[model samples]
Target: MKIYPIETGNFKLDGGAMFGVVPKSIWQKTNPADANNLIEMSMRSLLIEDGNRLTLIDTGLGNKQSDKFFGYYHLFGDKTLDSSLAKLGFCKDDITDVFLTHLHFDHCGGSIEFNKDKTAYQPAFKNAKFWSNKEHWLWATEPNAREKASFLKENIIPIKESGQLEFINLSEDNYIKNSELNFDILCVDGHTEKQMIPHLNYKGKTLVFMADLLPTIGHIPLPYVMSYDTRPLLTLNEKQSFLNLAADKNYFLFLEHDAHNEICTVKHTEKGVRLDKTYTFNEIFN
Candidate 1:
């Protein structure tokens, strides 16, 4: 199996929102904020080429939203989903599966796009089966007031409408081993309901896709939970358990939202789990 990093785009978000109640004095050290107090973030996705199946995890924010709609996020960057795939000698039609970690705008917005005439929305990857779990599908479709803004109908409804949506059944333990996508899925509910984190065995090492569960290296500490999380207490426990296991097993964390650090590993420090090191995607995979 071959893996590649797909950088879709970059944007800025309020650092306070990203780090939750964590003081700026602390988080700013790792994720420095701009003059406007927004921190830079990357919409990085992962592409896995195994046999004939090319699975893409998280589609990033697509370019279909109106300028006024995108003005809030402050999107910037030359990279895009199509351009990134082109660089890898591939295109939308080449993707067989789109595994969404969650249905947040930044994570799955690129899954759907405007049709040729811009008359209606359609699945962005014409040949790909959009992967989402029943629980998350329901949660996103019927979003609560707090998360309603993040779950845009334009980005999600088209997949189901296009008849390409598929649900991955969750096990009793919320873990799926050797899923049809050819990897283990670790399901957690703290970030959003049933966010699936993918675990892949690459080069004799376990690589985990750190979705919102651990957005950046700045969130390695036990208390650095995002304010957007509906259940912050649940997030604390989930992070503690996951980070401890990640440290003990030496998993290479593939960060999805960290703009500066592409990957990271944690270690058991006296102050609990802390960032051990960081690596660019090419540094380890190239």
Candidate 2:
């Protein structure tokens, strides 16, 4: 099995919001804020190639949003989906499955693109069967007042409209069965309902895709939950439980949004599960 780290580009997000309840003084140490209080973040995605499957997890923020809309995030970087795939000798059409951890604009926006005529949005990976949980699909489609802004209709709907949408397990035991991906779904509700985190067995190691649940290494502490999460308390419990299990089992956490660290290990420190070590994908995967 082979895994590729796709650089979908980088953008800025308010550091305070990204680390809910955590003071800027603390988070700024790791993610220094710019003059606008925004910190640079990577919309990093993963590509898995094994047997008959090539799955891409999480598309970065797409390019269809208007300049005015993008002005807020200050999107910058030359590494796009096309360019990144080219580096790997593949294209969007080569993807057979698109496993979305959630439907947030940063995670799923790149899944679809605007047509040249600007009349309609279309699936970015036409050949890929988009994977999302039924609960998350509904939560994103019918977004609540708190998270409606994060769930853009343009980034979504097109996959379903294109007749390529598929649901993962609802009971928590259902894992997507593909030759390339033999992983369990770590479904959590704190950050939107039923957000799917893929736990994979790769190269004799256990790796987990830490979506928004643990956006950065700084969020290893249990209380460092995101303000965007619907249920912060639930998130705390889930994070603690997961961290304990991860520390015990020695799982390499593959971060999705962290700008610097791609993977990390945690320890059961007195302060909580603190960052033990951090490394790039190749450092661990290779």
Candidate 3:
């Protein structure tokens, strides 16, 4: 199996919100804010090529939103979903599966796009089966007041409307073994209900796609949970447990939102699991 790091685009988000309760004084050290107090963030996705299936995990914010809507996020960079796929000598239709960690705008917005005449919305990956868990699908579709803004209907409904949506019935085990994808889904909550983090076995290494569960190296410390999480205390417990397991088993964390650092490993330290090393995808695989 081969994995490709797909750079969809970059955008800005309020550093304070991203870092949650962590003081700006500390987070700014790693992610310095602009004059607007927004820090640049990457909407990074992953492409897995295994035998006949090509799976894409998360589709960064697409270009269908109005300028006014996008202005709020301050989108930047030339990299886009199509461009990234072109670089890998593939196209959207080639994707057999789109495994969404959650249905937040940044993660699933690119799942649908405007038609040529802008008359109606359609599935961006026409031939792909969009994979999301039943719990998260319902949570996003019937969003609560707290997360309504993040779950845009336009980005979501088209997949189901296109007859390409599929739900994974989560098993009792933490690790969901899927024969179709050849990966285990590490189910997580707190950020959102039933966020599925893919644990891929690649080249004798366990590569975990750390969705919002651990955004960046800055969040390695126990208290650095995000404010966006629905249950912060629950997130703390989940993070601690995952970090301990990661440290013990030496898993390579593939970050989805970290703009600068692509992959990192944590080591057991006196202060708890801390960043041990960072690497680009090429550094380790190439």
RMSD of 1: 0.7
- Locate the minimum summed-lDDT window of 10 residues in model 3: 173-182
Q: Which candidate is the best by TM-score?
A: 1
Which 10 consecutive residues of model 2 have the lowest summed lDDT? 172-181
**Candidate 3 residues 155-202, lDDT tens each?**
998888899999877887656896346788988888998999999888
C-alpha lDDT of candidate 3 relative to the true structure = 0.91
Better of 1 and 2 by TM-score: 1
* Per-model TM-score on C-alpha atoms: 0.99, 0.95, 0.98
CA error at residue 155 for candidate 2, angstroms = 1.3
Over 4 Å off in model 3, which ranges?
A: none
| Candidate 1 lDDT for residue 182 | 89
lDDT of 2: 0.87
In candidate 1, stretches whose alpha carbon ends up further than 4 angstroms from where it belongs are none
Model 2 C-alpha lDDT per residue in residues 1-286, reported as the tens digit of each score: 8888899998998888889899999989988999989988888898989788999999889889999999999988788989999998999999999989999999999999987798998998888999887788999999999999999988888889999998875663533443234667777888888888888888899888899889998888888888889999999998988899999899999888888899999888887778999998889877
**Cα lDDT of all candidates, in order?**
0.94, 0.87, 0.91
Specify the highest-lDDT model's number.
1
The whole-model C-alpha lDDT of candidate 1 against the native structure comes to 0.94
- List pairs with backbone clashes in candidate 2: none
Tell me how far the alpha carbon of residue 35 in candidate 1 is from the true structure, in angstroms, after superposition: 1.3
